[model samples]
Target chain A: MRLFKRQNNVLPGFGLTLGFTIFYLSVIVLIPLSALVFRTSGLTWGEFVTTVTAPRVLASYKVTFGSAMIAALINSVFGVLVAWVLVRYRFPGRRIVDALVDLPFALPTAVAGITLATIYSPNGWVGRFLEPHGIKVAFTPVGIVLAMTFIGLPFVVRTVQPVIEEIEIELEEAASCLGANRWQTLQLVIFPMLLPSILTGFALSFARAVGEYGSIIFIAGNMPMVSEITPLLIITKLEQFDYRGATAIACVMLLTSFSMLLVINLLQKWSRRYAD
Target chain B: MSAPVTSIPTSNGSKKRTQTEPAAVRWLLISIALVFLTLFLALPLFAVFTQAFEKGLTVHLEALKEPDTLSSIKLTLITAAVTVPLNLFFGVTAAWAIAKFSFPGKNLLITLIDLPFSVSPVISGLIYVLIFGLQGWLGPWLQAHDIRIVFAVPGIILATIFVTFPFVARELIPLMEAQGKEEEEAALVLGASGLQTFFRVTLPNVKWGIIYGVILCNARAMGEFGAVSVVSGHIRGMTNTVPLHVEILYNEYNYTAAFAVASLLAFLALITLAVKTVAEWKVRQQLDNN
Candidate 1:
């Protein structure tokens, strides 16, 4: 490798820039993240299992993962619809609608939390009508789902939108001329091409929702076993000065993040393969 | 032997043969999208403002003028001020290295840069606490030195930086990668120094991408809640940022006050979105020209 290394390049400062990048990355991200692993290592296997698998913590896992799944699924459907409409059709106020897709990303999570809680709290705007029909949103797992869906909305729409735009209309026209109906064209011709990106978007939305905290906590009602999410559970542990327990649970959650990183890598490869 | 399909349009509706779905289908899809967006995106934004003004504009104004609220705003500003520039420097350097170089483990480095995005914000904040809190790795040393990192202004800044670590770099990497090293190579061959070439050629090429990244990074830095909250200790009038302040107010049953402070952030979000839209348009225009 050293023998093959080229030193003939004209560009300079590679050493300075790369050194700074590695040093900064190590100090800011790598070292701190390793602290989680180091701290978790202090626990015995028994202790780790007990901390992560406690009934309350287990419930939070269920709540967090379940609601995030539901939320990601919801975003996958509606986000694709939004992207499809935004790309394929022109309606009034389209630019405004397009810009608004990113509101959840730009809006502070706390503001989203309070606003969502207020709007869905039985006596609030949409909640008032739903309450009459025996539906309660705020202070429930459903509210957690709502918040997650809101935060994850832009991921799917943004990801799928470009892919949708890249889809050639001639393919659809060919399908139609071949006597396949609209639905057949979409299902047979288009959906396969879009699948990889759709999965990527779904995975991204799910990952973001899984890690979400500020927005879900306010709306989640934070009942010990019912609506409490894992992030909130970690906060609860930290508040109680249960540092060991907090990191233990955080270690498990961190595993999820690492796995997400892997999944993202694989998805990128899959999408690249399709692109080629 | 095939029938002439061109004549089929006469039997179909007069809406011209297009690859798109029929008009009725289009209207249905558009309506669904509009309603869904309104319910999820538009109304909550509307709610933040309406709730803020529900107790009259005077109360909303008073909430904004509240001492704690003002202090939180100050802290938020300070945090963003410090965090954005630091991350901006890292972003440019990292992008410069990764985009222009082809060393081994380059892909791994790129992925590592994005590590914070996948991690939970609580964990992002917690990692520092684990290092600097009373029970952490440097806890005794920090306490002895009277240096505070976690649960203070420094902690807040650290967490914001972590959460926003990848934004600028991520924006520039792809952009610079696509722009290729030709321009900088040209500048160098013309006797320009490395720094000179960077400032004159590379920076201009990625200026819009940098702007887009900085705007986003700044917005997240100021608006970050979960990470900042985990590290902030939520000490009102001191460590609490704007989002945390809103949380405290809302939890204390100060709905009007909470939404009032929240309206300001909502405004920030709107401004960020507006800038983002304009930046995106500018970039698109540049692309079209190219």
Candidate 2:
């Protein structure tokens, strides 16, 4: 059985391009990533388990995955609404609002971290108001969620926007002709059509939020067992020169995120098939 | 920008309504979207600029001119300079192979290209650290050679490259794929050389995608923090990129100076968005004409 057998296409340089692609990817991505696995392999199984499942590490996992889920959930509902508004409504400054959705993507994570820290710090602009109500945003788990939400904002809107635009008006029209109210038509017809994209967007956002570091650290207050995230724990271990501990935690995060991405890929493939 | 609002016609009755929402409902949804964007997206951006100039214009200018800030900015520019071209070349080549050809394990190849995207940025930096750090794979050789990577400019550049690796290729693949190989085939039939066919036919077709990709890649390359932070040992004027410098200043309670640097980054983000919007419009126009 042959691997990399090329079909009889007129495109020249397939070998050159493919070979270059593989070389670059291996040097830049694959080989380095496998370093994590190799380094982690130096540890005994019991030591690896203890390192990864320590109370502090476990708590960081909770804070990380929990906040990512909450943020992605929030993004889903609002993202769909935002997509609906952008595609269906004719509002002034609509194009600018559309552009602003990509701000999270364009802005650096560190800038986002500090700016959010400033805005949500007790004496800061938005935070001052919330402070009076006994609500603290910065330096808490809530702050972590807020940062993750900001980081993950564009994923759902960008994912669902095109899907919403592609929804045939005829389906809605048919639903309307069948004596469905606006709410009913939206719930039964439009929502079902949007489910797959919404799921894709949610998974994407969740995955991104889980891996996020820069934006959350400033706001999370770095209180281990309470708000410190998994990435930060890895950083902490690295700082202490505990390469073994760091690689163990990094490996866990990597495997989890990789599987999540694989699931998202399958979901997208299934959705495409379902669409066809 | 005002596309006429067309309400689907329906018999005016309490039981039946048009496809469009009532004006009140329409305005409510629009208001929700506008308010959400303003609170979440617009407000933090406003805060960046406001905080930067809080100590007045001269102070802001002085902060930017600080030797450390200047060096950090220089380092960021240098990183983007090296990273973007490498990725741009890789993106074009990868897209040419994956988009234009049918071969074995193409999906797997695409997945491998996208692998960096899903990895935590810190891990992206760590993987390199594992290779170049003092106890890492090449650490002994590198140390024996008196070479620095993990805590130096080279490590920062590698981390940025790793994080921004997928941007260009991701943007170009679907585009070149959609554009098929027909044009290249036609150019070849006319006796164009392979390079000539690529330059004349394929490059122009995907030029906007390339620009858009580069714009995004440059933004992230310059703005990357988590990965660069791990690799950069916070050497104030040496390894510190702009984002890392912002962290150092902010951590030191130099709010005004930190915001000053961050505002420049924010400004870059805005410019990136504007250029991206135009590139997307150009691409759409190209598609419509085709």
Top candidate when judged by lDDT against the true structure: 2
Candidate 2 error regions (>4 Å): A1-7, B1-17
After TM-score superposition, what is the CA distance of residue A115 in candidate 2 from its true location, in Å?
Answer: 0.8
Model 2 DockQ class:
medium
DockQ (model 1, Cα): 0.59
Q: Lowest-scoring 10 consecutive residues by lDDT in candidate 2 chain A?
A: A1-10
Candidate 2: tens digits of C-alpha lDDT, residues B116-201 = 99999999999999999999999999999999999999999999999999999999999998888989988887788899999999
> After superposing candidate 1, which stretches have Cα over 4 Å from the reference?
A1-8, B1-15
Proportion of native contacts kept per candidate: 0.81, 0.79
| Tens-digit lDDT string for candidate 1 (B58-171) | 998999999999999999999999999999999999998999888999999999999999999999999999998999999999999999988899999999999999999998
Q: Tens-digit lDDT track for model 1 on A1-276?
A: 231256756688889999999999999999999999999999999999999999999999999999989999999999999999998777779999999999999999999999999999999999999998999999989999999999999999999988887776677788999999889999999899888888889999999999999898888999999999999999999999999999999999999989988997899799979966
The clash count for each model shown is 0, 0
Candidate 2, chain A: TM-score against the reference? 0.96
